[model samples]
Target chain A: MALVELVPNFSEGRRQDVIDKILAAMKEASTAKIIDSRADPDHNRLVVTIVGEPEETFKAGFAGIKTAAELIDMDEHQGEHPRVGATDVVPFVPVTGITIEECTELAKRLAKKVSDELGIPTYLYEAAATRPDRENLANIRKGQYEGLKEAIKTDPDRKPDFGPSELPKAGATVIGAREFLIAYNIYLNTDDVEIAKTIGRNIRHKNGGFAYCKSMGFATKPYVQVSMNLTNYKETPMAMVVETVRNEARRYGVAITETEVYGMIPVDALLDAAEYYLQLNGKWNRSQIIEKKLTEME
Target chain B: MALVELVPNFSEGRRQDVIDKILAAMKEASTAKIIDSRADPDHNRLVVTIVGEPEETFKAGFAGIKTAAELIDMDEHQGEHPRVGATDVVPFVPVTGITIEECTELAKRLAKKVSDELGIPTYLYEAAATRPDRENLANIRKGQYEGLKEAIKTDPDRKPDFGPSELPKAGATVIGAREFLIAYNIYLNTDDVEIAKTIGRNIRHKNGGFAYCKSMGFATKPYVQVSMNLTNYKETPMAMVVETVRNEARRYGVAITETEVYGMIPVDALLDAAEYYLQLNGKWNRSQIIEKKLTEME
Candidate 1:
């Protein structure tokens, strides 16, 4: 069976009734399974992680997006995280027996459906981008909801890849296809934020570090951390990131307290690190693993 | 569906026709999938690894065993590897949605079918053993095919667990249930067999090493290796074994050239090592992995 993953970010997080209703709409599809659903009240956003057949995942995502649009009003929406619409970002990730191109096609198909059926403007970003500028989600959502609404009227460049050159009350939605992103954070023993910031800048791709790594420094209450979004773990790997961060932080006399994986991670990301660390040569395919073989039987 | 794995060792391997007939029987059972099948001419043995629903696996295994028994004659069998019968050892492994107890039950059922219908005397070992002494497979087939025929008649303690005391012309079949075992080997750069033997003794549980590890020294052509059978990877881990061997080999000015995983391994084994080496903290559940989530969707 072909499996694809959908991670849809919703505007509502604090209200249980609204979240439950949106989740119910996804559950109503029946074919897809909700692998994980988390709401950060601080971020004031809900991230729903769903996995199933491509068609089933699309149906479930669409239903959830429609339900979110009905329940949320972007005009009154306030969150620490940036957003454009009730369904902020809907990304299609190829999981198993599926390719990135297939996910891109699914993303485009879903984006068109959202624009035509739901009367909401959608912009294709990442692998599904129609324009080079739309390749990065941050660039596409540069103005957010309020700024994009005004910019759409005056600037031709602000026009979305899908739908009319205007934003609805629930605002605009961004749809795209991308590899699975691993949100990894390594905490330092000291509260010196500068140490983390320096390490983050040195280890991130934009600042001359690992090619596929994007990093930033953040203070989460007690500790300073190097928060990273590994865009392509196969190229850079999670272990290399952690090791480099550890080695860099040591220069500032900062010891690693612990590391946290914020969301879902790909198995290959972990397995690649294992192969390197163990120095295991010869044949060591994931399929050879017992647990993986058992999963195949299932 | 609950999944169980069966690894059956057959006495004949030189003839491709015999191997093909056995595999054909397993292929005939639609529900069971033959994950791997290897024929070692030096051992004159064929090892077929299959996984599927317990009932389907048993049906397939029974058909394969019957085909093997009919074609192979113990009087004509000669091999480099140890053996006592055509279908020497049939071990049932609990894969997914299946417990060890359930595998034990399946082993007994297979043993009964083999003895009743095929006229092959069966001895249960490991988790399916009726007597405590018969739990170890090596102890059951101690004398191999040549000595077993006379030994089974004279020795009361060496009697078959299921069937008549006398060994059939096809020889006695040893059937049991055991945890998945990973056959791993680490080759040293140096041709010093003594160095490999010393490192093997230091890491194996029987010789006061890791609890779940069994080690031995072997020379394969140009390389001398520390061959190990990890009975429980969760307890001992593959990475720890490699590290310990590497550290020990370093004392003798020997470096590990490479490592080999002989057969199917569990995904958890690799993941465990990755987590340890990477120092990834917090709840590291397999459910949080995208590839695992994809498999769950199926």
Candidate 2:
């Protein structure tokens, strides 16, 4: 058994009935554990998080897309967040006993299912992209719901990897596979936001920092914060990023006030932190964790 | 569905057939997980580790004891470790949703069962002790098997808590409840044994240090280590212990090399370290961990 995480973003956040119906449909269709469902009215999007076997997650994700298509009209949808479909984007992340390539296969199966059954064109992005042009989600969603509505029928470049090259009432969906993203924030003692910004800039990928990190600085009320989205915890670990932030803060005569993990995070992240901070010399296996051995793979 | 860990020590480690029979009986009798079983020939003892619901664990541990009694004759048993019975001692430790008091009750039930049914005398120690004199395990086994045989029939001070005054072929069994013992060792960068010994002394309870810590210094092949048995992790956490060692090592101008956790450890121990070292300001609950939420109470 494998544990794969699926985070599906739907374009109907303000309407509780629509989200509930979609959630109920997902719960009915799949055996996956629906861990969380968050709706932001400002973004007008509902994001659901689940952990289960790859096939079970696909069944749940497909149900969500089908239900969203039936209830949400893309033309009527308006929000601060960008969208190209009622079910905007769905990503399959490998949790345990599964590889990224395997998740890509699961993503492909989900895209084909939504496109064929719902009569809505679907584009594969990220690891599951059919072409180099469709690799980035920003590329697939370059044209919003209204723009893509016209482009899909005409432009060969705008054509989806599945279904007819025509957009329906639900519009086009972008589905793919990606690593788990950790929403981590580090708070600084100083009131100065400049120091936070500098550390953020030096530690984010675009500025020749850690490869899989995207960070920003903010002056949030009581303390300055260096907020980050760690894209690949295995490649660029949490401990290294934190230690770097600590060392950088010391140069400015400041210390870390506290830290925050914004949402649900895998146990491995904390276990990794334990190994590094405690200076465990790779003398133990993760199986030695009694709870882990007892837990069956999702 | 409370999780309780039971570690049972039997007096025959040199005989593989006897150990196998005991393990098989426990596995067949109880719907509980037998996570580990270690045999130390020098001590001539077998220690089996189990984690399950209180009743299920008690059934499994009882099965092991019954099997050990039938196979091992204590009069012929000789070992480096102190023992008064074929199934020397069994200790129950609380894992999750289970209290020490509940475990003590389970211990008492096991003690009474072995004594009444098996016709072997039983003594309670630690949290399950009937009297102040029986609180220490060493006090209960003051006269090993050979000496305890005559003492049990003659001396009032050496009387057992349960069963007849006459000794059986299997001898006496000791049962009780105690906190989980983590065999943790911290290695220093230097070869100096004195620094390790001093740090060990300052951190152990017997010398007026951390309440539940028991430590000793050892000069292993590569490093001088402060070997420890942390009796209660909730009160004296792993992060606090390691940090204290780091702080103490600084006084001797030595740095820590690495640390080791000898065997099975509860996931909470590592999570405690992560929360402290990462400086999470009570902003996150352990329930927020995806794995923790997915796992049943056990």
| Number of the top-ranking candidate, with TM-score as the measure | 2
* lDDT agreement with native, every candidate: 0.86, 0.90
- Model 2, A112-147: lDDT tens digits are 888778888999988899898888888889869988
Question: Which tens-of-lDDT digit does each residue in A193-276 have in candidate 1?
Answer: 888889889998888999988998887658898998888776788878888888998888888888888778767678888888
Please, what are the lDDT tens digits per residue for candidate 1 over residues B1-298? 4677899999988999999999998889647788888999999999988887889889888888898889999999999999999999999987666778999999999999899998889999998999888998889989998899999999988888778888877899999998878899899988878888888898998889999899988876588989999987767788788889989998998888888888777666788888888767674566777766655676
TM-score of chain B of each: 0.80, 0.92
The pairs that clash in candidate 2 are none
DockQ for each model: 0.54, 0.74
Regions of model 2 farther than 4 Å from truth: A14-17, A40-44, A70-80, A116-118, A130-133, A296-298, B14-17, B40-44, B75-80, B116-119, B296-298
